[model samples]
Target: MELTLTDDQQELRRGARRFLAAESSPDKVDAAMKTERGYDPATWQRICEELGWPALTIPEAYEGIGLGPRELYPLMEEMGRHVACAPFFSTVCLGVNALLCAGTEAQKQAHLPAIAAGERTATVAYTEPSGRWDASAIKATATRHGDGYVLRGHKRYVLDGHSADLLVVAARAPGSTGENGVSLFVVPATTAGVTRTWLPTMDQTRKQADVVLDGVRVPADAVMGEPGAGWAPLARTLALAVTALAAEQVGGAEACLELAVEYAKVRKQFGRPIGSFQAIKHKCADMLLLVESARSAALYASLLAAEAVEALGAGGPSAGASAAFAEAASSAKAYCSEAYFHCAGESIQIHGGIGFTWEHPAHLYFKRARSSQTLLGSPAYHRERVASLMDL
Candidate 1:
């Protein structure tokens, strides 16, 4: 089957490219990365308020654009291209997706509109110090306490956690293990006993934090969906987010290819542009192939995710369909992760010594590549996941 963007989608991509170039230029991105919040507040405001980015996937009733996952392709790719620093990933990808997947209608009414309005920022605090994204990695406890729940856990590697206005925390019952008793809670970031600490990371363009919930208490309404049945929604959320992330990886890989080719053409060696050399030529060709392959994988997976979302609205899908969607997600995640990292590393190699310097943009992309490879799940982990889904 042939897949091509509609004219509207193409326009959206062009518009996004223009906006990112103007707002997240190389110099501006460099400056933004050094900030405590990892982005300019005004720029973020423009993204949320002016561009209505946070509302792209929100339902129409919630004052949003009501677009599906496929619509997010352009914006995510643009963010990856510029490596723009913002809470969009945490707020839109993690937070919004978490709510959309698991949230009750009441919960959606309470939170999503604020996000759509750009008045709130949120993220999913799912990973722990164990550095795992699976339900088995969730060791936090949520105990009943007078019509509410008291949560105790320390979440590490929470994207944009330190600054988000809200957090959707995943934890299990006191005696539960793995997927059993898993539940999600929406807690205000300023709630008592909730402490957030920013952790320094290799990719400063993306901010992560350590969030400790020490006996944090929230009302019963904070519970998203049915208690002890959060695993399915969370899994879907991860699948969707990772597919979007794969799209971002494609854009980053493309950027690496362009950067390498640009340098190969301008940087002279042996009295000629190094791009003229067979070795450099081969590397650029390989990078191009990786980028193209990654883009195809990302787009196909994204369309599957869009179908999954539509399925959710129509009372969910059958077991077989869910498995198929999961398989595609794992495939895209695995291939895109490796492709981006490979392209980034090749770009750095093509730039030679200058690429390793702090002043050069090549190193930034390289670091992001390394960090993203292990974010949702390592490429190896996704491969295993795919195999399991295939029952191989």
Candidate 2:
């Protein structure tokens, strides 16, 4: 696979960085994070209207831009570096991916246009209070009743759930058992008996919610795919999410390295620049190595995912092909997670006491790094998945 980006891809990267630098300045991000909604509606609208970002990866048949992960990875990197407080991650990376992976023609027709137009915000509700990332760990149930299903149970750590108009939920359907029985359903957030409460998070820039579906009922058609057969699609969606997140981690790591180097060149101790000190120089070198390594891993994983999608066509990939993409995704996620946190910590160290303050963006990167490391799965969890894929 080619590691170098094409001219069009490089142009996309440059445009993204320029746009984010102007629109997502640190002060704006801080203000948005401090608010209850955690993002500016006007800014989000502009992104959709001017940049057409939300449609970047959705298929054109659904009125989307029909781009692939190659375009998405660069945009995610820019967003991460800017610590952008937007719904892109939840709405595009998780929600849109779920629809692409599992949504039938009718379902895609119903949802994708609204999403591509940025008229509706959506998120996937997967993890429960158990906090396990495995499909079999789902305890939320959708019990059949007449012509529909009644959903009961809570979903935690739902990204953008509090503001999302649509929720793609994973639940255990009646008459099915274990992971095999798990199915995906689309529920309106305003549906009766549904409660969304924002959670206190360390990374305020990216908010999460606790969603309770207390006997919320929906039509049988709410199911995304065949009943009791949602695991494969969900798994594929998660592989895309992992690769998306890895790209973000690489961006964050690069930002951390930049922050450290810029500070070290200016901050002085004992009548000399601290960057001249062997210890600080070594730290910056290590951060650069980490950032570049993570970037390559993330980029390669994204390419693999996009290629797999192309090879398998829209009907969905074969089991072996899907597993191969999943392995690459898991490897990238594992390495990038640790690398981001490491770079963030070193950036803080290089910045001294200022890094700990709330006013400084260093703390923001640090918190985001810590939270993102465990979002889809912890580094250790992905490592375990990688080992399993290797038959270790």
Per-residue accuracy of model 2 over 1-392 as CA lDDT, tens digit each: 78768899899989999999988998999999998778999999999989999999888888899899988998999989999999999999999989888887788899999999989888999999988898777899989999999999999999999999999999997656667888899898999999999988889999999999999999999999898899878988889999999999999999999999999999999999999999999999999999999989999899988987686465556778777888999999999999999999999999999998988899889989999999999999999998898889
| Quality of model 1 by C-alpha lDDT | 0.91
lDDT of 1 by residue, 1-392 (tens): 33456788788889889999999877888898888798899998998877899999999988999998788987898889988788998899989999999998998999999999999999999999999878899999999999999999999999999999999999999989889999999999999999999999988889999999999999999999999999999999999899888988988999999999999999998899999999999999999998999888888888888888998999998898899889998899899999999999999999999999888888778878888899999999999999999889
Superposed by TM-score, candidate 2 places the C-alpha of residue 151 at a distance from the truth, in angstroms, of 0.6
Q: Estimate the TM-score of every prediction.
A: 0.98, 0.98
In candidate 1, list every pair of residues with a backbone clash.
none
In candidate 2, where is summed lDDT lowest over 10 consecutive residues? 308-317
**Per-candidate clashes, comma-separated:** 0, 0
